[model samples]
Target: MPHRIAAIQKLTATEPHPERVAMFAIAGDSASGKTTLTKGLVEAIGTHRISSFCTDDYHRYDRKERKNLPFTPLNPECNYLEIMEQHLQLLILGQPILKPKYHHADGTLGRPELFIPSEIVIVEGLFPLWSKLSRATFDVTAYLDPPETVRRAWKIARDTTKRGYTTEQVLSDLEQREPESEKYIRPQRAHADLVISFAPVEGRSSLSATILLRPTVPQPDLHDILTPATRDAAHIKLIRDQDGKPVDALHIHGHAPEAASRLVEEKLWEKIGLGGDIPASLGRISSTERSAPLAIAQLIILHHMIHC
Candidate 1:
């Protein structure tokens, strides 16, 4: 796939202080591991350098109200989108806002409270990059694009276990969410500076990842140097997936070797010029670029701060 260059590379300031509370957005569809990846990034960056958050806290209505909506999860109409954008702007400007809480397990909204500011705040959830008003607040934005099959399976498992949904119920909800996903969620892809995906090979648990940099950046072909052993262990393989289309027909899943993903990550750090191995709390992946979705987010904010 051919790469796209960002039309506007202007970096917007997120905080008054360059050293603290820069804003980032990780946008993706349901079950794309946005939360898991964000958590890993927070751990990798260390709690001291980065603070963590989920835009899931910004829901206007609790799960019950959401379930009753005509359009389900992807429905922009159902969420307090305007409110979310408003509060995000408030928080990004280094001001405090009354944050709401939603408890998925109970399908309820918890009490609201004021959250003090932090150095780096990660906003991860569906539609984190939904509107121009909200998208502008982000210095870096990444879109997650794991294969549909893997996403569906992950959704089924997650909803069933964590959210008290049966497989049948999950399917029904997914179907309802599909239309809005195409209309609202998918288009957000164009707004992202980077797009990354993780999928399994034909017969394995090895998760392959692909990262696409907006042509505006100086990122190189990161797939070349991935070693054979790395691919074998992580089960990651990279096929050119430029412009949302596959370049070659390669089997994904456990079929991919771990080296494929590692090679890309190795190239990631070498390019970023940011050093130091990944911290232990961030899972077994030791490379910084493997955490591209989040790290790129930081770069976005940093660029704006330096330039602003």
Candidate 2:
């Protein structure tokens, strides 16, 4: 929470720009839907207006090198934290950075590439809000806090299918990473303006989403959209957070009728005042599948990007 004070102080010390680039941070453990959530926002905002990249690229060791290391990639010591912070500051100032690349498929360090910031910048990965200075760079920040069982399943699925790991290997790596995840990764949730959790509803195939809207930043007023008529699809209520603070919690049911979810989406899109149809790219889980809860979550975040 000290970082929040630092963030406020830093913002007040700097001269505001009329065309200042808005920056968002999505922090979470490995395969906790950070990229998926960021992908939707980029598509909705347009690639020309937003630039996004993973902070995992700052890892100090490659896959081969990590085998002998004592700490996992989730540890702050395992990444170039200072460099990542510097690059983030530069990006917020509308400057370019020669960003490092980490190849997720093979776990190798790739060539450094030039990264230019656009009207909006989304930095997603494990350590975007790890430090006070780093936390000060974002206009909005969110943390994905999926259930451990669900996250483990997602990690296993992604690693086996795309990263060429066997089911057993992925499980083993997850067990090893759990301690670091608890120590370094989960703590960042405290720094986020929004904390998102996506979990399977009982007897449902798709995942329902729960978002905690913290008072750290201005959030969209959803009282008009979350009426009893839309309760089957989405609703909002005051709840006590982990820290015992009262916060607004928004729940989007995955099993809700398509029409019901669409109505909520329409209301949110109108609130965004973008003056166009909702982006077709919202809610896409894959080329073939989409989740209404995911779509609604993305729209709420998009609302923050435009209105907040």
Best TM-score among the predictions, by candidate number: 2
Give the per-residue lDDT of model 2 (tens digit) for 1-308.
Answer: 99999999798667655367789899999999998889988988888988899998999999999999999999988999999999988887777899999999899999999998998889999999999999999988999999999999999889999999999998889999989998999999999999999999888878999999999999898889988778899988899999899999999999998888999999999999988898988998888989888888888888888765
**Per-residue C-alpha lDDT of model 1 across residues 1-308, encoded as one tens digit per residue:** 22332323223433245344677778899888777777766765666656656666666777777766666657776677787888888877677778787777877878987875566677878878988789888767778878888899989999999989999998988888888888988888777766767765455555655455565333334344334544432323345555664332222223433455334344444444556753343333335434332333333333332232
Model 2 bad stretches (over 4 Å): 1-19
| TM-score on alpha carbons, each prediction | 0.72, 0.93
Give the alpha-carbon lDDT of every model: 0.63, 0.91
lDDT of 1: 0.63
Q: Candidate 1: lDDT of 234?
A: 31
Q: Candidate 2: lDDT of 299?
A: 87
Q: Specify the poorest-scoring 10-residue window by lDDT in model 1.
A: 246-255
Lowest lDDT block of 10, candidate 2: 12-21
Residue-pair clash count for candidate 2? 0
